[model samples]
Each structure stands twice: as structure tokens, then as C-alpha cells.
Target: MASESAANPPLAGKHILLGITGSIAAYKAAVLCRLLKTAGADVRVVMTPLAKQFITPLTMATLSKNPILVEFFDPENGAWNSHVSLGEWADCYLIAPATANTLAKMAGGIADNLLLTTYLSARCPVAVAPAMDLDMYAHEATQQNLRTLARRGVHIVEPGDGELASGLTGKGRMAEPDRIAAFVGDLLREKKKSLQGKRLIVTAGATIEAIDPVRFISNHSTGKMGYAIAGELAGRGAEVTLVTGRTSLPTPAGVERVDVLSAAEMYDAAVRAFDGADGAVMCAAVADYTPESVSETKIKKCDGDMCITLRRTRDIAAELGAHKGSRLLAGFALETHDEEAHAEAKLAKKNFDFIVLNSLRDAGAGFRGDTNKVTFIDRAGREELPLMPKREVAARIADKIEKILK
Candidate 1:
């Protein structure tokens, strides 16, 4: 029987195929192998021919508790190391110390060795941790190759910036063993389709209200929270529609994005998406007012102070709430004073199933930041959450959505 500690690990019972490539960082593969094993994964090692020179097969074999594979067949016995079988058995394929040469080959679909062949055959998710000299890592070709792999759904553990084997310092160092192991564990955990068959709408970023052709009023919201929620929903198999304002964030995987610039535009898109959605997360920082009369051209710089008229924009959440019927609706409140009161008011006013409340006075709790301290408020009561990463907050929100859906 497996030990309690071993069985309780995040990677427990998972089969991991670790690929090593030719690089000075190949020596770190031994440590990575050990970490994966310690996390209760059944690890098997595959190495390129040149990788053997940097890290001995015996070292990897001892750590993995399995023979390292380097060729298609054993020279002495003619026994085959079947790539197909390896591919089928693994829950994840991790290529650590993935050299620039190997990355290019992977990008080009070159299967010249056992490791590459296994990668081509693998049915599981593939993750790569790149390692190379600073210049090589910065080269446009390498960047393009990495982008290609990313577009094909390969998980990339971005290289760290530090001293390289070439006696120079810059980005291209492979991530540490512990970090790599944790990333693999996370990748596997995210594969669970907990939200399958559900459709969701997420509104994100700060809506722009134009005052002139070049000048617009917006907020500090970067759409990080909303984007994270959308990503989390999509990861759990929810069909997500992201209704977003101006932000540079890429669309999350498996999400349909509808771009909008103004509060009016967002209101239109959100309503349309919400009609077919199982739930809606109203996370955008929308402008409450717009210029009553927008100037067609840029306003001239005048010595005298100018006054512009303002009008209230349409309330997207309230409109959706009125017509929600059986659909779930979640709203966010960013407050500075009387946080709980404001949140409860919004929760009641918008008829939200629950409202996520964050105080701007609390450090790292709102807008343009990566962390948040929030409270989930409903008619029953409030559940306060500690300060945490925005992604984790998104997960908690997703958990609530899942329960309401069920």
C-alpha cells in the first residue's frame, strides 16, 4: 500500500513522462524527476541522445525508479520502448530543460528521437520549461516557436531571468524543480470538467465614455478579475462569453470574446449574451455617466475652465437582473465607505444570487491589482474571504457558480 503522505499528494496516482533535452540545464532534470516522484507521481524518463552526456541515465533511473529510455529498441535484446504505450499511460508529458533546439523541433513537428516521437504520440497535455542562452531566448525565431507551441495548447513554464551557462546573465534559465512539479500538478487538476454543459457570461475591464474623439473617461480596472473568472469557468468546461471593454488581455482558452468600448456598447453585448447564459458575472467597472453631448473632434485647449454635461448610462446589471428568471447572476461592489451596506444594497437592488464585495481601502483588494480581499454576500449572510490571488478568488466564485448551477 502507498504511504499516507504519498497517496495524499496532488499528483498522486498520476503517470508523468519527463523529457530531457540537450542543454547545460539538463542536470536539473534529476532534481525535477525526484520532485515528481516525491509528489507520488509514477514518473518515467525519456532523454535525447545529447541529454545523456549532461545527465547520466543511471541518475535519472535511480530517481524515477524506472529505466530511462533513450532509443527505440535495446541494442542487446531488441526490446522496443513503445512511444505509443508511453503516450497513452501518462496523464501529463513534461519536458524540462527544454533546449532551444528541441523547442524549434517541437514547433516544426520534428520527431527525430524517442522523446520527440513520444511527444508526437502523447494524448496527454504537454508542458515545456525552456532553457537557453540569453540571446537565443530573445531571438525572434525562438519567440515565434514558443508562440506556435502555445497556440497548439502546449503549456509553457516561462524561463527565469538569471545567469546562464555561457557566463552571461539574462532570461532563459529553466524554472526550478519544485515550481515545475507544482505547475504539472495544477495542469492536471484544471482538466476536471466540473462546469460541463453550462454557459456563462463575464463582463470585464473599465468601460470608456467618450467626451471627445481622443479623450474618454474610464476607470483603473484592467479586467484582470473578470478575465480570471472567465478563464476559470472555461477551464471547468463552461461555455464562456467574455464581454469586455478596452484591455490588452488575451482571450482565455475556450471562451468567446465580444469587444466593446463604451458602457452603452457593453450593455448591448452583455444583454445579448446573458439571454442564453446559465449565469452572468457582472465584473466590469462600468461608467455610471457619459458625456451628454460628445464633441465630434478633440476639444481645444482653453485657458478658461470648461464644463461638460453628463448623463447616467444604462444599468446593465439591473436590466439583466429583472429578466434573469431561473438564470444565476453575480455582481461585484467596489466600495470605500460602508462596504457591507453598499454591497448588501446592490445585492438586493440587482437581485443577485450573491454579490462579491471588495473594499478599495483594503490594500490589494480592487482594480488594476493581482490580489483581492472579498466578501460574498447574499440575503442569508456574508462570508468574508482572506486576501488572495485574483485567480484563487475567481476559483471561489466559480465554486459558488457551480453550486448554484447544480
Candidate 2:
């Protein structure tokens, strides 16, 4: 196990602050600390005063190789345990086996304990694993507190549904140590600032073609994939400019959004933003053609079919490609047939560094879905990916972008 852990240390050099609250499940914190240590993380344990009854500080300190912190100051020596300093040192703060009382206190901003005070001062991502009886877990107050914490960007590792300490066979069991360790590792991995100081442009959603005042033509794009990419890049410390068409999705954090209603407007916005961008992801489902002339007013129902001449819209990707020069340009191809061939052609024609290809025939690979199955096509070759959440896909894309930027 030691050799295996050394071979795959995902959290190497990461500083993890582990918080243990009062609960029978506090016993699991020792195992969690060991697992985190095995994964090459520097672990520090902080315990609530009430937690000492269930788990000994000596055990945690032995596993973590760090002194246990339970109080603000040591009465024996008058040395201080600075919560602010601890908060700043940790890459991530994890509260495992968090009791209902601890959850409530965290949600309410109560900082009576050293762990709670550290949580309040921590600037890093915070995660909690709730553990309690089924009744306490299912109560509306608890649920509301969880929701409130979630809205405040707290990562919640939901309790498992199994035998509880209360002798009831239901939900509200704290997740096992292995799962908690994996969650912390994954969370810290995603928080890496690989693209820091880079500037990126991303286009998203379906561009509309207006035929009348109240009627317009658009595709089924919900901007989920593009928004995910923007969020991923921003999370990696990139300055992102999102040139978006019509979509109800909220702007991703740390991304500057430019909203447009039509393909022409989107083309203008994207082109302008790309001038100062280091790279661009063309993910918008832009219209190939738009009405040459729109009606002055709403077109009433007519017996004969109405005819409106259409003209091609400006190709945003091709324009960006022409001016991309040394900058990276990535585009998406949503195809019904000959997916690879079309993607490759577009990759060359638009001078894209690579193209993401998705076939309409594949289930969950198209627009309006939270999941996607995609293949990356570049001059080197192709890399196919399995169907997964849009966020994961975005991460993969961001990883590739980082390689190019580096």
C-alpha cells in the first residue's frame, strides 16, 4: 500500500486542514488523516472540544505528524494557536464527520471553537461531511442549513444511506474515510491555478435570427458546455471573456460576459474580444444564415406559405482563425454524419489548434444536455472521450489548453 500510494500521489505537497466535530463518527477522522498523509498531503488536525471524548488527540497527531489544535491558546505555556494563520496555511479545509450541531454552527457563522474560527477565516475551499441520525439529517432545519451553506459555495459530501449509530437503518451515516480522502484530493486538484495570468475568450449559446418582432429562429443550445468551459478556465485563474448569445444561464464567476441576441451581434462581440485574448473556444451554435430582410411588424397567419430570402451570416470562427496568428483557437463541431472528416476540415480551414467533435447520433452528446461524449481532433491524431458531465469535459478541454499555453 505504501508503494502504491507513492506511485499515485494525487495530493502531493498539498496542505489539508482536517476538522473533527463531536460525534461517534469522529473516530473516522483518524483514518482520514492517515489516508491523506499516504496520498502525500501534509495533514493538520483541528478538533472541537467535545470531539475529544470520542477520539483522542494523540492518535490524530501521531497519524498527521502535526500537533493537534483544540483551543485558542495553550494554558500550560501561553502559546497561541492562531486560527487566521492556520486558515492561510491550508490549501483546503475539510470538516469530516461534521455533526448536525457543527453544521448549524458553521451555517450560522458561530465560531466558539478553534475549528469553527478557522473555518470562518479560511480563504480556501471548504468541504464538510455531515454525520448524524436520520431524523436530525432529514429535518427541515438541517436541510435548510445545508442549502444555505451550499449557496455560499461550500462543498458538501452527502451522508451515506446505511446503518446509523442510533441503531436505525436509514440515511445519515458519514461517508467512509477512503471516500472522504478522495473527495478532498479531487477538490484540491481542481483548485490548481494552471492557467493563471492567461486571458481567454469563449463564445456560447445559440445565435438567433429574427424574422419578425416576436418570432426568431434559434437552435436548442443551452450554453451548458461553453459556460462550463468558461467556469473551468476562470477557476484555473484565467481572465475569461464570454461572448454569449441568447441563453438563460447565469454568467460564470470571474468571467466577463458580453450578451448578444443575433449572429451578427455575436460576431462583432467575439471578434472584438479576441483581439486581446491569448486563446478562444468557439462553442456557440451560430446560425449559418439569417433572414436577408425582416418584416416591419409581426407576420400574421397567411394561407400561402411566406417566403423570406436568407443570407449567410459572418463566420465568427473563420474570422478569428484568420487573425489568431500565434494565439490558440479551439472550435466545436456538432455533426450528424462524417464527424471526424468535418471536424478535421474545420480544424484546418479555421486554423484551429484543435476541434471538439460530437455526433448527433450519439446519445447525450448534443445540445441542451448536461452530459457530453466528444472526440478531440487535431493535426497529431484524435482522442475520444466517454460520455460524462459537462464539467468534466470542460476540465479535459482546459487541460489541453494548458498544455498549448505552456
Candidate 3:
């Protein structure tokens, strides 16, 4: 394909680390690697010992123009090929033909091999495309492993349903190389240009209110949904500034990140960014109240019970609503009771264009997970979205923004 005729392959400049495991689909990786190279990405190949039974290291090395690393150390001199360095070097770690065994190891944190070790150390995004025989793919163990990896932040490139290696037709075939490349390109592109020209500010995670420097009140908010939304928005060509309270979640690609602590700090950061933003998603679980005053030092644990004074924290959304005009404001409410009534009141009071509501009663959602099932409410009514990956949830929110802005 001509450089211009190639549709500006989104893989260009992506440092893609390819992992080939023991599977019949391993052969397809050669073509996949070549296509990735043609698209202008820097490719590096990693092989499992079993992978050698299917494909030659020399073949992969020649195709990638880089040495292949299959083990932690070279057998000849015992020189180390550091998994840490490999993890640090790549922009993305991709496993094509990821076998059920590898998926189980990845999900279970079994680091018996170099590939698994590198996976644990990788700082960038990890995506896996599984390939297997029909029955093996549909087994309960395999399905559980896949879900475990998904929950642990690994992207599963869903396998296509078709003829399998065992001559049975089912959903075990790895996606075609070209389609996998396209999917990866979309993933990378989603992190880069999808939100261009639109300004978005998202608040995420939980706020910490101090009773003293040594003690603070917080919650179980992982901020996965908020971070995912920020990432998807940035990928779609939006300039995003993420105003967040404390959370372990990494900052999304192509986003300007701001970290805050107490609700007061969050309020300050969010309102400041709202001015320049075309829209804002208030997703952080900010504390409704905080200690009225702080002790100069840690409060000593006494034999008797103690009472502390509490005060209402400034309502962030309401303050923003007072000033936000025509800007698409999105709010999230986690309700345990009277879900609709509370959500509706919040929408009207905060002047949000729409509100996303999820219940504590719902499974696969809330804190510390990748999946979310939500009900999105606009002034018109509600749309109940099925349980979906948080990333998909982000896509839906971005789609709504696109509709409103368009």
C-alpha cells in the first residue's frame, strides 16, 4: 500500500510488543507483525517456549528487525534479558494467539515465564486476542479466565465465530490480522484524536476529609469510570483536563491531569476548569460532609468514645450549575434507595443535561471493577444501559456529548 493510500494507519509510531504463545494461530502473527510494520509501528516479538514448536524465532526476528526474547536469560552466557526493560520500552503489549493457559496465568498472577513476568511489569496498555479449539474456548475455565483478565484491565479482542483448528465451527478463531490491526488502531486512535477540539473536564475517585494529618475519611471509589470517560473523550479529539481526588488509577492518555485531596481542593480545581470546558462530567464521589475543624495532631485512641463536629461540604455540581450555561454537564448518582427520585432531583438541581445512575444493588459495578451497568436519565426520561465494560460506558457518554454538541 502507498504511504498516502494506506488510510494513515493509526499504528504509526506505536511501539507494539507482540507476544506469540503456543497455539495454531501463532502462524498468523507473522503476517500480523508484517502488517503492523507496514503501518509504521515499531514491532518487537516475544515468544513462549511452546511458541517455538509452531513458529521460528529467526522468522519473527527477521520480520520485526529486532532480536526475539523468549526467556529471562540467554542460555549461552546467562546474560539477563530484563522483563522490566521490555515492559518499560513498549507503548503497548499485545498478545496474539493468547492461549487459555496464558490467560489463566495472567489472571491468576502466575509469573512462571518471561512473558507473564513482562506482563506484570508493563506500564502501558495490554491487549490479548485469544485463539483456541472450539470446545476449549467455550469451557467455563476459559470464560472465567477471560473475565478475570478483563477485570484486571486487560483488553480482550473478542474472537470471531468460525471454523476452528479442530474442524468444528465455533467462536474460537482469533480475529484476522488485518481486523485485529484495525481494532488496535481504533483503540490507539481512541486515545488520541476522537475528542479533538472539544474541551472536557472529568472529576473522579473519592475525596479525603481530614480529622487530622494522620486520619482522614474516604470511600471505596476506584475512579475507574471517570478515568475511562476522560480517556475515551481525549481519544475522540477532545482536550481533557481530569480533576481528581486520590485514586490509584493511572491518568488517561492525552489528558491533562490534576490531583486534589479534600472536597475543598476538588471544588477549587473543578470549578476553575469548568470555565474552559465545553462539558464536564462530575463523577467523583466527593464527601457530602467533612470535619468542621482538624486536630493539630493525630487524635489519640482513648478508652472512651469521642465525638467530632461535622459540616456540609460545598456542593460542587450546584456551584457549577449556577455558572454553567449551555455546557453539557453530566452527573453520576450511586443510590441504594429511591434511585429515580434522587437522580431526578439531582438532574434538576444541578442543571445537568443528563445524569448517569447506577445502584449499589447492581452487580459487576460500583467500586474496584471494570464493568458497569447504568441507567442514563435526561430530562425526557431514562435509558437503561446493560452491564458493559467501563470503557464502553465512556463511549456512550461521549456519544451523548457528540449528539448534544452536534
Candidate 4:
């Protein structure tokens, strides 16, 4: 069960794909299905056959108003149920009580069932709440699988610690249905209220500096923070234009999204939106330089090696800073040495009103986690925020933007 406070419910008019796998907590999927329906989302459930051993199909079918898909083809007429079509149909894909076996399959590319196939084929953001015995979850294999899935762009809803079905418990309990629903609603609804009437632009992910047709240099950003910020802003009320590099992240609600591959493409998108935008958050880790000349085709790997010359890409931040007076411009700096000095220098040079400085050395602050410990530095001074989830960090950024445009 979630704590005392209930999140605001605003998940109306959204299509949610609920994937149910085999686990003891499968029964809770029914209640979760109900909660989702009550909150205004269109729910559809796809279950692994083993999942039916715990929860009846009729129960989920009644709540979702859609036939539960379990097999690739119907046994009667062999009518096909395409996973790709299902993936594209939903705004978000949710899997509650995800089992250890399923997680392993997901991590290793074992598409033996309809659920796994759909998950593999999903284009929407996938959120999984894993459920298993304490020992099964504590095993190294499980942890590794979770990390692999996370790195592969799957959102793992961390399981709660408590009593388990085995009568021995430390963790691995599935979160309560109401709380799970609220969490999903919060995840989806977070930005709806904040960005409703405003207009903003978010540049996210790592920009590629192509060395040749087949190779490029980039960072390990994965674009999580930037994408999260964009989704949050759109959820709140703002018209968000998310200009993202190559990432598997889905388009957030009520946002006009543009996809790009390189710094040049991202630069083009950012400048065009800044033309009439109220503000912008340059959150991408843009490559500092690009290969001076890209080989038309893959460079042959022959002889000792090769030296590829590089040239600086146009400064997108500088362009916006020059014209961004009444407009609010926010920049993100992932620094290593002389953190504050570098951020402040860039703050002045890039003409950013504020720069979010995160030191890579700091634990849980830099990249690849749901949390961050950051120091927001602007012209006034610096305010160090406690380590918190990236969602909260995004909220603080939104709060600052509200103050600016208000």
C-alpha cells in the first residue's frame, strides 16, 4: 500500500497497456486494472499463460473491456494478434507483479509467450513492478536482469520490502494496487498540471559525433532526465516541444516531439523552436565536436589504425543566450573537474540564466539513476539540493521556470 498521501488523479484520456506475467501477486492485477479504469485510462491486459493459473481471464476482461491476449494466434481460426500493433496502440505499457522468469526472458530476449513478445515489440514506455520471493529477488541474477532491463530503457518500479508469500520476507513484495495506480497516475500526470498553458522546449539525450558512416562518439546519457523533464512539463500543462536524439523513449502526453540524431540536427530543432518559445531547457549532452569529415561509407579497418580529426559543433546554448533576454534559458552541465567554476564560466559565456551542475563523481547524481544530487547555480549564488529522485529534480526546475514566467 502507498503511504498516507494520495497523489492527484489526472490520468484521463490515456491508453494504458497492462502486461500481466506469472507471479503470486497476479491477483492484485485485477484490482490494479479496476483502479486504472476508475481514473479514466483505457486499460488492456495481456497475460502469460502461467499468469492465468493465478488470476482468471474473465476478471481482467470485465474490467478492461478488451480480450486478454495470451497466445500468438487464436486456436480456433488462427487469427493473428500482432504485438507491434498493440505496442503502438497504447500510451504506456505497465506490467504489475512481473515474475523473475519473465524479467530474465526480457533481459535475454526470450520471446516465448505473448506477453514477452508484446513487451519486446512495445514502442511505448514500459513500466514493470517485479514480484517474487525475497531470496529470488536478492539473487545476483535478478539484480543483473533488472539492471540490464533498465539500461535497455525499461522502467523498473522498485518493489517494496515486507512480508512475503513464503513466510520469510525482506523485500520483493508487489506494491499495493491502489498505490501502483496512483504511482502510474503520478508518473503520467506529474507534468500535466505544471505545463498546461506555457510553452517550453526540452533538448535531451546524447548527441552523436559521427567519425564515419558506421562509427561515432557520444556519452552514456540514455536521455532519461531530459525525457522525464519533458514528460513532467507536458503532464502539468505546458506545450512541450521535446527535441530528442536517438533514444527509445516514447512521446510524452500533450507534447510536440521531434527526434534528431546528431548535434547538428538537435541544433536545428532548438533554434527553430526558440524563435517564439517562452523558454527552453538545454538538457542534452551535446557532443563537443564532430569528425572533421565523415567517411561516405564505413572506413576500412586496416593497417595500424586511423586518426580522425574533429571540429567544434555550433554552440546551441550560445545562440539562444544571445537572443534570450526576456526568455528563460536553462542549461545543464555534467562536469568533472572544477565543477562550480566550469558551470559558472559556462553560465556567463553561454548566456544561460541558470545552469544545472551535476558532478559525475558524486554518487547517484550524474547519470543512469532515477535519483540525483545537484547544485543549481545562477547569477545570484548557489543552492545545493539534497539527493532526491530525478522526478523531483525536474519538478524543482519546473518550479524555477514558473517563477521566471510568472
Per-candidate Cα lDDT values, in order, are 0.90, 0.90, 0.88, 0.85
RMSD of each: 4.9, 7.3, 10.1, 8.8
- List model 3 lDDT by residue over 21-87, tens digit each: 9999999999999988988889999999999999999999999999999988999999998999999
Candidate closest to the true structure, highest TM-score: 1
Q: How does candidate 1 score on lDDT?
A: 0.90
Candidate 1, residues 2-53: lDDT per residue as tens digits? 2235538777889999999999999889888888887889999999999988
How large an RMSD does model 4 have? 8.8
Q: After TM-score superposition, what is the CA distance of residue 387 in candidate 4 from its true location, in Å?
A: 2.3
Which portions of model 2 show Cα errors greater than 4 Å?
A: 1-122, 126-184, 190-192
Residue-level lDDT of model 2, residues 309-348, one tens digit each, is 9999999999999988999999999999988888999999
TM for every model, in the order presented, reads 0.75, 0.63, 0.64, 0.65
Model 2 scores what on Cα lDDT? 0.90
Error of 1 at 265 (Å): 2.1
Q: After superposition, how far is residue 356 of candidate 3 from its true place, in Å?
A: 0.2
